[model samples]
Target chain A: MPTKINIRIVTGVILLTVQVLMVIYARFDEARYFCWAPHDSQNEYAIFATVNDQTLTPDQIQKRYRIKQKGIDPRAIQHIKDIIERYETTYGKDSPAEVIMHYSTNGIEKPSWRWPKT
Target chain B: MSVNPLKIVNNEMEPQLLLTAKAVVLGLICGKYFFKLSDHFLPVWPIFDYLGPPHVFEAVLKVLFIFGCAGILFNCRVRLCCIILGLVFLITPLSSMVSYRNAKVFTGFLLFMIGLHKKGEVPWLVQAQVIILYLGAGINKLFEPDWQTGQYFEHWMHNIIKNPYYINATMLLPPMMLSKIMCWLTIAVEFIFPITLWRRFHVSFFLWTGVLFHGMALILSGDDFGVFSIAVLCSYFSFVKWPELIRVSFNGDNLLHRIAKGIVNVFGFDNHFVWQEQAGGPLVATINSQTHTGTLAFKKMVLYLPIFYLAVAVLISLAPTAALKSKCALLLYVLIFPLPEVIGYLKRKREKA
Candidate 1:
């Protein structure tokens, strides 16, 4: 019984600690895992990708990111950026692909992002 | 028997509430996966590109999740089921970032907490986890300038949801003022919920309020939030004071009585209700020593029965209109309390004709 009680207590503490840490981490991070901050931002973004001098269509962009080419991302715009970065630096590394994303957060237009930065 | 509110409130360790909570949480999780089975089987994100057909791994996890849910639902190897479901949810996000919902991770942690405890033990940790979720969300929103200033709410209403009611309200009042009022009210509720939920006196009040709050959120946002509202609402069962046993006596073995018995036998897995036939007596249900007759007794039975409660929840979730969904409690009240009596009356009239 004592061992069982101890296990419960330890599990409780660890879970609580991780949740708190995630909440704190959300302040600095955009992905916001376990933070419970839903619909925090309305990131209206459009992603344009050019590969071998041919611009990728909306369907192609959606296929690449597994998200719509242009839509409102409820999380931070940074998440969309991260996805693009991860894809570009990974399987698409061999291909000469340039990506640019124009995004607005909370109805306020922000600076556009360009991959393979100038 | 007389009902003792104090006794019910004081007995915080009722195992039935925990069981019901498990049923609800797992039920919602299963519904989500079942509805979107295809999405889970596919590895949509670039992160899984190097994993060489990550779909195979995802398929295995999803299969395990379904199996775990079945085990939990059937009340067989529940602890193991919780652990498996928890691990599946925890690891699912690794395959694809799109799968990483806060509610899913929260559910994972909650299941893990439940699994760590012994059977029939008070899920104090589960309760605490819910409290922490509210506290974390409230604090996060409290500090967020956009949430505080109504910018986020305005963006959500004007651009995202484009709620006609909000637009109409803006005609009479300034958009910022109306938005700020709604935002601050939400912030206040979320911020105060943690404190209120801790107090025994305030638990019921906040629980109902939380339901309404989440219900409204679901209505306003539609399904954009997925099962987050359902998950949180189900977790509120952790704080509920469930009756240990219900004693019901019927006048005689009529059609209604037989149907009631059938329901009790099928849905009452825990044997919470004990039904007795009493010749030439009024139909009555005794719970916590409190006796209720007529529609009230029927309502009490339905409310206490886990399957019925879950059915009502599923029905409410499927209600067509936002208005109907938002007024879930009232709808439930009508359905359970008076609608059955109305149906019985119609049936009797038809039989007479």
Candidate 2:
């Protein structure tokens, strides 16, 4: 085996080489941004509302309902449906167009929305 | 202070546990869940866009990844096993996205580097990786005004903050100013993570801080991140300096050093070897009269234990008819935790040779 120092130099060179490759890949090709930063969802997507057809203001919905544009699964759609139903039962017949879930795709600002699946 | 990462030698037994923990993660996640053809994916590389892991090949690659992780868990031809997985990732198109997370990529590189670092000492590259990750995260947080104001973590415990007086065992702070304080404290610690690499800093304090941070993350974060907190905590194993089981020097004995010596004596192997717990535990030390009074824990004569355990695990995995691959997993610790006697035997053999 090489001396630990020599081994470390080799490891350093390898790390440097891979980092170079990563930079090139990110710069030219489509690589995931290696920022190592956590996403701030709240500030980026500032819209928060409940919708039956027309968007309801924050007070009508009981729970905290923030409109996001991704992670559109069945459960979220159901949550939207439940919220809309709750609003109508208590406040008596708001716009019944539909409840929807919206979030950013890839947890970044690319807007998308999905209607609730009944 | 610029400290030499190469001089930071780890005990011979430390990497074994780290590798084992990584293997446990692989066995649980890749072996259990990631094998599904529909879900399994190799992150998108433009060159390989058209060539995804084909129908049957996908299954083969997943199997290889599982076995490769098993091979590493046991320390069998780890370099080769890691290369095999690397090849699988290269050849297969099982990734759901065009790219994987930076953490995944960093760990892949780490797996390769450690596989090559067969001598049991943690590589300087690994040290650099850990330090850089913390620094990068800290610097990123520093740029965010909200983090400076300690906004995110404060609201992270929203339920308790809303209630006038509420307390749960899990919720340590009642969503008060303490949340902001803890948030800033965490960021400060992370920013100074590089200081741990310096010779002046006490490694144990930072390591314990890391343990506490991850422990809190595990308890408080709920299930959002899955096993990520545990995984990061396990990576801390690479940084620990194991307790020296054989002593080579005549430095003035401190009380704890004396106690460490007593503990080694109680465990036997006292006749031919001296012991000290400088920081890490169960490191092999080679002693010779002509050489410096005692050799430090850089000896790699006994690293094959994990390989042997891996073989045992492989044998067990194959035999159990309704095999849950993890059945043989816990036995890895059983094989590694004991045996200064075995290390002594290896030392004697090296001397004879």
Candidate 3:
């Protein structure tokens, strides 16, 4: 009986600790997985990209990101930034793609992000 | 006679509640997986690049997820199925940052806990996980400047949702004040729920509040969170100590009663209700020595009947408009269903006076 009680207590503690830690981590991390803060931000964003001296259309931008080119992303604006950065640094590396994203977070418009860091 | 929330225990175990929870959670996951399979025929997501060039590991995981869901639903090695499903949810999010949703992770954690649960034991871990979820959500929102200042709600309602009701309200009341009120109400409720849910007396109140809160969210957002609200509501069954027997007596001669009986026979897998003919006034249901008549009795019947509850949830989720959904939910879940009981109580009080 004591062993069972201890096991239960340990399990409970481990489960709760992990959840609490994830919640804390969410504040620092851009990808808020395991965090309960859903819809905390309404990121209205537009993505622009130029690959090999050719400007990509909205359809191309959507295809690249697997998200709509211009729409409200109900997460942190950083999520969009990360996706753009990952794609540019990865499969599109050799192509010399220049990407820019202008976004507003919760009615407050922030500066645009340019790929390759200016 | 008042219905005691606790003390409704069977000698074996409350398999009904557990099974219902499993079905709802797994069913929602299955639906999500179906969409994922259709959307990405091959694992073109960045996370799949690590396993192999061909995406064989991702393919196997998807197949396993399907089998896991089927196993759980068919009652074949439920514990093993839960573990497999839990692992799939845990690993799937790692494939891409975009796929990571708080609801998915929470669902995975829940399945893991469910898998570990022993029969006839109080589900302390499952209950704790729920409390932690609400508490984390509340605390996070409390600290977020956008949430505290009502900016998030303002932007969400005006731009993202384009909710007509909110827009109409903005005409009469100050938009900031209205948004602030909504923001604080949500924060308070989320915080209060975690504290209250642990108590037997408070569980039912918080559960009802949670249903209304999440129901309103689904209406306004239109499945943006994707079964998060439904999963949370279904998880509330974990807290309830469901009655072993629900005796529903109705007139067998009546066509309506016969139809109701037929529905129960078809859907009530656990045989929670004991059907009998009492050719009299309204349909009466006796649960835990407490008798309910009229619409209240019908409400109780539906509450215990998991299939009916799930059907109602799906219908609410599928409603096209926020206005229509809110009106229907308020009428069925809140007003009309309980109005008869309130009137009865008032009449009895007047008679005694």
Candidate 4:
């Protein structure tokens, strides 16, 4: 007979197994069902790229940069550079990613100042 | 030469010590990823939809694997398990690149609890959780005057329950009384929860009161805090002899068994109750069955999924937090004896009443 400790061991195993299976299932489920958006026939992974120059906000800038790293858009590289240049003016040349992250998260309205025309 | 080999051997094979370590790692992994998954999947905040479906799915899988590993470690020898578990857990926060520092702090808290363990100590880990949460809650409330005054949280809860967008059928409860009871109880519970840990009251009384308080919250707030509270309650009984749950489960089964058997037969629900004709009408059926299924329907379900599924999600969300809190609270109560403790004084009033 397994001890109480043994039961906990079993519980742990069950929890981990369930989590792993759920992840696998959820991944397949998303890919199968909700991957596509109405805007595109192909599933467009979310990212912020070149926003037509005239339209720029810190929020969009930050969000685009995030998606850029996830391999969403290569074009976002220049825009990210532009945003970094603006941010570094006040935040210093070596303003870390943490500052950018913090600003993006806490600031209710991203610096864009206007709504994006979808 | 007097050799200390025996002492060294004794030090090495400490079973309880190993369990303490296991509990800490298990608790950390469970806390970190479970909450992370919830945040991604059924996010409390609507705005942060950044994780997207694929990343959310990945997170869920990570949580499952972490939980699986903890279970595997449980059956193994304690010392070896602890070493491996501890290392994995310590590395986890780093691996996850947790942006929210609360997750890291929560992990540290569990590790601290593990470090403080003495041989045959009451499961301090569980108790410490409650105390930390109570204090955290108290501090949070202190920051928000409306919560302390029973305005903001009460109004928020009232609106949430009264939301017509969610529950159209209202006869399940008397809304006015339920609302009042919920508001009053929440305020009272938050206020007195700290005092419940004081030594004056019998531990059983505190436990029972807590169970009732959370039970009310479960029913009233759609099982908001119920899950966590239940988990916390379980930690108290860790010292119970083996297979205690099985014994307790079957203990009063003669009457329950008969009633359950009778109900099962009467309802003809041996398998799941499959409706021949849509149980509620086409519209109802559409809402309950067709339009909403799986996580895609989770948002719709959250807004409206009868009562059971809503309760299940609420319970699931609260489960880990509650258990974590209870263990934490108990740990602190024993370790730190409050000076000029008013908690003892508060206990006598309840007993006399």
- DockQ of candidate 2, scored on C-alphas against the true complex (2 decimals): 0.13
The regions of model 2 sitting more than 4 angstroms off are: A1-32, A38-101, A104-118, B1-33, B36-43, B52-57, B86-95, B98-103, B120-122, B159-176, B198-200, B243-353
Displacement of residue B108 (Cα, Å) in model 1 is: 2.1
DockQ of every candidate = 0.53, 0.13, 0.55, 0.03
Q: How high is the TM-score of chain A in model 1?
A: 0.84
Q: Chain A vs. true chain A, TM-score per candidate?
A: 0.84, 0.29, 0.79, 0.27
lDDT of 2 by residue, B21-56 (tens): 443335335323344323232233334334544455
Better of 1 and 2 by DockQ: 1
The weakest ten consecutive residues by lDDT in model 4 chain B span B242-251
Against the true structure, whose DockQ is highest?
3
lDDT of 1 by residue, B1-353 (tens): 11211111112224544454355444455356543432332234444455555556656766887777766655556667777877776666555565566666766776766666664576677788888888887877788788888888888888888888787897799659888888888888887888887765568657767866775676665541554565677677777657777899986657777777787677666667787888877678997777777766877787777666666556655656656655664554445444454576698799999
Report the lDDT of model 3 for residue A31.
Answer: 62
Write down the TM-score of every candidate. 0.80, 0.51, 0.83, 0.38
Interface RMSD, candidates in the order listed = 2.5, 10.4, 3.0, 17.5
Candidates ranked, most accurate by TM-score first: 3, 1, 2, 4
Please give, as one word, the docking class of candidate 2: incorrect
In order, the TM-score of chain B in each prediction is 0.74, 0.55, 0.82, 0.41
Candidate ranking (lDDT, best to worst): 3, 1, 2, 4
Report the error of model 3 at residue B209, Å.
0.9
Indicate the docking level reached by candidate 3: medium
**Candidate that beats the other on lDDT, 2 or 3, i.e. the better one:** 3
